[model samples]
Target: MRPNREDWAAALAAADKGRVAALADRIRDRAQVDLLAPPREGLMLMQLRESVAGAAFHLGEIPMARVHLRLTAPEGVAEGGAALMSDDLALVTRLAILDAALVADLPEAPEIEALLAEGMAARAETQARRALSLDRTKVDFQLLSEEDE
Candidate 1:
């Protein structure tokens, strides 16, 4: 089945630093890209809400990095951007390039699709491992039965 936009986005977001960089490098080698906004690091407020419709609250600020890139593709000019929670400037730059390549539908799109699949699989494995750890700690109330005289 073909992956949707959300799946592709989640894959890129979940990818590790090394994988993102490598993919970005591959895209750069094949296309002409311009840095619309050079990598910039800043602090952004982490907002939280009890629910989707609940009131929001600030959970303090965290370091964030972002980059914007534009590339010339066969179709036209494609703009791509990426923002990350960490302060890794290089990683954000690479992600931006990858995003642009995806938007441009370059020849390397299939490679990117493969990368996304790999990233999503890795994320699923991590989540399964975490779930297993949590399951181990589950408290079974049936085991706590008590008899009183």
Candidate 2:
């Protein structure tokens, strides 16, 4: 299944970087892309919420890159934007292009969807490995009372 708009960014971020770049480059070569806003690179204030107190606090600053652009392809035209926690402006710009292509339902949409699936699968595999590692170190504590009984 294709990822929804809300999940599109995450899927793109998680997918293989080389593959994503290739697809983005292909779309870019055939389309007229106009940057709606100059590609930006800066630090974003990281925020976090405390689970216990339900309070929000600024964690720290994280390097971030953002891109907003419009793509005009033969099939359609669409605008796309991407903000990611990295200082790679080119990568972010490429992501924005892919976002536009997918939204435009350009001929490359299926390829984009395939990239998303590959990324999601890789993310799931990484999570599973982490869980297994955690489980290996898990310690079950026995109460003193129970031990005596």
Best by TM-score: 2
Q: Estimated TM-score per prediction?
A: 0.73, 0.84
Q: What is the lDDT of residue 81 in candidate 2?
A: 88
Candidate lDDT (C-alpha), each: 0.76, 0.89
What are the per-residue Cα lDDT tens digits for candidate 1 across 1-149? 33665455456767665767777887777678888866789899999986867989998999999888898866556888878787877777777777778777877777777778777888798899999999999986766764321
Q: How high a TM-score does candidate 1 get?
A: 0.73
The residue-by-residue lDDT of candidate 2 on 39-134, one tens digit each, is: 889998999998999899999999999899999999999999888888888888988999999989999999999988987888789899999999
Candidate 1 regions off by >4 Å? 6-10, 13-19, 51-53, 74-76, 135-149
Error of 2 at 146 (Å): 9.9
Candidate 1 residue-pair clash tally: 0
Best by lDDT: 2
